[model samples]
Target: MIALIDYGMGNLRSVAKALEAAGAQEVKVTAHAKVIAKAQKLVLPGVGAMNEAIAELKKLKLAEVIKEHIFKKPFLGICLGLQLLFTESEEGGRTLGLGVFEGRVKRFSNKLKVPHMGWNNIRTQNSELRTQKCFALNNIPANAHFYFCHSYYVVPEDKSLIATTTEYGGEFVSSISKDNLFACQFHPEKSQSVGLRLLENFVRL
Candidate 1:
């Protein structure tokens, strides 16, 4: 079963629907740690303030459960979900993340626009190298457009973790992959066909 984590901040219904459409036979949207712990895969999808989201995860003690699952199973994070895996976020004054990756979530520069919304194309890293292909991006074409709505983006200390980069005013890390984990700053659920393909790849993985 796939656990679509519900910590009161994610777009759960839409994400769940997308997963089903992507061929996930079982997708459970639950806040219960027991349910999450038993899931074969975990999908963390979120929006809104990082501080509040992290607080809710801690309050429910899902944070540690999520950490344990990440190391042993397939984990996918969307938008703020991706941000939460970092060491910390500048959003709302240095909110701490799960620290799965060494990075900081930073707001877009004032010169550019806040909340970089709408469709943006992403260039996958090492798309030419078969060995370096990201499983989440399987069958997804290069420069595929994905939906995005966020003020902040992640900057991982380990550049090798970056899977894709998108340009909005300037280039920013759009996705990252390491071991069994794949996370993206964009909303694959809202990205239409290409997005569905990405989710399907995750489901199959």
Candidate 2:
């Protein structure tokens, strides 16, 4: 079963619907710790403030539960969900993140736009999501374009988790992967066929 972590606010239903559309056997949106810990895969989807998301995770006492599960299972984060995985964020006064990835989330200053909302191409960097045993790509194209909706972006201190890159005014970090943890700055639920394929890929993982 795939578990979608739900706090007070999130793109809960849209993500759940998209997961089902992608043919996931089971999908549950919950804040329950045992449900999250027992799930086969976990999807962390958010569309709100950085601090608020972290606060809710902490409130549910599922923050550490998620961190523990990521090491042994497939864990995915989206948009603001990706941001919270970092060590800190400049969203609202240097707020701290979940500290899974060693870095900080910074706002865009490239003069392109505050909130970069549109379709963009993705270019892969250091990626293992391609040839993993259960994650067979078959005829699917890797590094294809997906939907993006965010103002701030992650800047990993290590630079190794960067799986792909997308441009907005300047080249901003798009997607990242570390072990079992995969994340994207875009929303797969809104990216149509490309998005659904990505979700299917994650589910199969």
Candidate 3:
């Protein structure tokens, strides 16, 4: 079973449907720790404020559960889900995060638009290695377009973790892949065919 974590945020049903379309036989949207623990894979998809999301996760005691199982399974994070893995976020005046990755979430510069919405193409960082080893990006063509909607973005301390980069105002980290984990700032559920292909790759992983 693939656990689609629900903390009262995100397009849960849409993501769940998309995962099923990608061939996920069993996808459970749950906040219960036991359900998550038994899941074969975990997907964290969310939107809205980071502080509120973290507060909800902690209130439901799902945060620790996620941390414990994150490295043990094929974990995927989307949008706010991706942002929460970092050490802290500037979203609400230095709100702390899961600390899974050594990084900080930053807001886009004032020169450009606040929410970097709509379609954008992601370029694979290291085509040779990523194409061969990154299962989440498997069969996904480089420079393929994906849907994005967010004002904040992650900046990891370790550049090696960066899987893909996209340009809005300038180049920004679009996705990151390391071991059993893969995350992106874009929403695969809304990206159409290429997005479905990406999810299909993740389901196969």
| Per-model TM against the reference | 0.95, 0.91, 0.95
Residues 21-51 of candidate 3 have per-residue lDDT tens digits of 9999999999999999999999999999999
Clashing pairs in 2: none
- RMSD of candidate 1 to the true fold? 2.3
- Candidate 3 wrong stretches, greater than 4 Å: 126-133
Report the CA-based lDDT of candidate 2 relative to the real structure.
0.81
Worst 10 residues of 3 by lDDT: 125-134
Pairs clashing within candidate 1: none
lDDT of candidate 2 at residue 189, scale 0 to 100: 89
Let me know the TM-score candidate 3 reaches against the reference structure: 0.95
- Give me the displacement of residue 199 in model 3, in angstroms: 0.8
Tens-digit lDDT string for candidate 1 (11-42): 69999999999999999999998998899999
56-145: candidate 2 lDDT, tens digit per residue: 889889889988887788988889888988999998888999998899899989666778888888765435323231232223465677
Give the runs in model 2 whose Cα sits over 4 Å from its true position.
125-143
Off by over 4 Å in 1: 126-132
lDDT of each: 0.91, 0.81, 0.91
